[model samples]
Target: MEQARRVEADVDSCDPCLSVSHLSLRFGAGCPSCMAPDAALERNVCPVCGTVHAVRDVSFDVYPGEIVGIVGESGSGKSSLMKCIYFDQDASEGDVRALPFDGGAGNILDLSSQHKRRVRNTVFGMVYQNPYLGLRMDFSSLSNIAEQMIASGERRVDAMCERGYELLGEVNIPARRAKDAPALFSGGMQQRVQIAKALSNNPPILLLDEVTTGLDLSVQASVLDLILRIRRDYGVGMVVVSHDLGVIRMLADRTLVMLDGRVVERGLTDQILEDPQHPYTQQLVYSLI
Candidate 1:
């Protein structure tokens, strides 16, 4: 098996918004054993266990304005890797360094709690598997988006309202319906609303975890188109996690394949899909067709 390797560069001489070196995460056995058997899980065994386990030693880089896809079967560590990068969980070992707006390179793993909060709020945006969960079903769409800004401490009411309406329009939600709650909208509409909220702060990077799941074929196509459009228009780097090769073909510039919690193969989208080097990746590609 290939352990994740580090690509080293001069730390003092690189762009700050994104730079990760020798990053690794391990979740101990007690962590998984503590959860109910029915509790949701992504990787097979605990990453932190001393035994030979899944998702071992993975590492990679994401450049500014680039869209990278992590593709694999269920329980392939795709989501786990994303969670680690997004700060949803802590990596037991390794270094994650990101450039903050203040023009300093800060270690993600060692940041002050206050700085970590700022990094999540101001520099990174995340879109989850379910769009409904991203928004408040009880609040109007406008409120859902406005509240995100408010949480970030952008308190000027007029600016928030204006920006909120603009975001709705940007996502093609008409101003008339902007005040409606997500429950009133279709799945596709709800997904768009989620996108608007994710883009609320214009963060440099977007982490999308199966954002198109459970939608009809037509709706999925539309959502994919919107995602591509957003990437082109905003030039934000994206990390897309999906099991579908078709989705990856349509969206990812590069692809990484994970199996049993470890990355089995990786390459440009065309190369990996057309001429996969790893047996697991080959099986996955065949299964997709």
Candidate 2:
């Protein structure tokens, strides 16, 4: 009898425009020889060294309008992977191929810095783990959101401000507070402001790096609900990097489980949660419970 071949998930649903293949990244290589001995050795020496790998050879495709969760413990390389996909960091090896709006083929990694900035400004947006990092402490919430639209070349200050106020209202922040800096708001309110900023340009893909960290349980739940609503309303593809299984269950259609810098499992959210096959995944599920 012939051995059975493992079946892969259908690629039909994956966006033809976004493709990532055999991605890998490592640190310590950038250290100069004069600054550090064994710099060459450090190049290949695992920073995590038999522990975590930061981001091992990983590959995945994200379809337009799909919500994918990248879940792992701290140091599992969830954030690093998102950084690479978002073009914030260069991958040591592999390819991130994307199609331009004009139907030109482009490699995100190979784009010139200027082009990369253009893509980031107009084509992609990100939400940081800390809401304060996304805002200007010296500026009002309305101005913070409008600034992003301006940077992305929206050009008309009046229009940006009008749209900014509309987004603030959309995220449920009161118009009265629009003139206040995010510092004056509670954690949840600040997060709402961050969401408004991230959505200002209507980017097709939104990379959210632990958007609900450090909040109380109720606040976290509310933020997650708001995120889900934004996903439906905007129809944007989202990659949510989080350690919280509850949040993943609420938002992700598919989940990728990372352990010590490697992807240990990938499957539907409920299936993997219920019947995880990898030992590391089992431990993660147990820890969640």
Candidate 3:
């Protein structure tokens, strides 16, 4: 794998908006045999202890105005890592810090539930792979965005409505459909609504998990375009997780390749696409060709 020389130069000056260090998420207790540094497990599962190490020792930083991509096969811990970051699922152990929260001095993973919620509302905006998980299906699209704004402590209805309409249009959701429930919208529209809701609070960082997985190619393109537009317009740092390298190539400034609960390769997107280090990463890149 040819490592890009430019990555170090590009990140030398700016402080990271989000930093994750030695993050790990596991299910069930681990035995010494499977817990060793040299332990070999079946994929991510401990054969002896029946424990699933969904993510292990993953670390990364997202700088303001940068888009970082995490790519891997299904069950490779990519989505699991995102879930852990957003507190959808608590990580067994890790440290996550955002500059917008506590001057980046506190480990958000260890914060109280109340403080964590505050981080979710004010500092990080999350879009899940499944629209059902990210949006209120029974609520109006406008109401969905307002819900997020309200969580962020916005009390002015007129202000929330203005923001909601602005975001909906930004994501290409028509104002005419603003009052319609997401249950009545198509998958792509629902996803647009979710994106609109995620941006309702003007968060400093966005966590997007497989936002285009099941959409049609054209719809995926539109969603991808919307993401780029959002980044350009809002200048928010983003962590985007996907199984597709093509998507990463289209959007990520930096890319991380994961396999069996660990990051196997990381570099500038072009560097990884041009020269993948790990065998799994090679397979993924070559498949795209």
lDDT per model vs. reference: 0.75, 0.76, 0.91
In candidate 1 the C-alpha lDDT for residue 287 amounts to: 80
Q: What TM-score should be assigned to candidate 2?
A: 0.85
RMSD of model 2 against the true structure: 6.0
Where model 1 places Cα greater than 4 Å from the true spot, the runs are 1-17, 29-54, 100-104
lDDT of 3 by residue, 232-254 (tens): 89999999999999999999989
Question: lDDT tens string, model 2, 205-265?
Answer: 7789998889999999889988889877887777899998778878887789987566889
Q: List model 1 lDDT by residue over 1-289, tens digit each.
A: 0111111122123454565554545455545542333333444553343332334567666666567788988767678777777777776555665554454455676877787777777788888888765789879988988888887889998888899899999888999999999899988899889899989999888889998889899999988999999988997878899998889988887788888666778877777777888998888778867
Q: Predictions ranked by lDDT, top down? A: 3, 2, 1
Q: What's model 1's overall lDDT?
A: 0.75
Tell me the TM-score of each prediction against the true structure. Answer: 0.83, 0.85, 0.96
Residue pairs clashing in model 3 are none
Backbone collision count in every prediction?
4, 1, 0
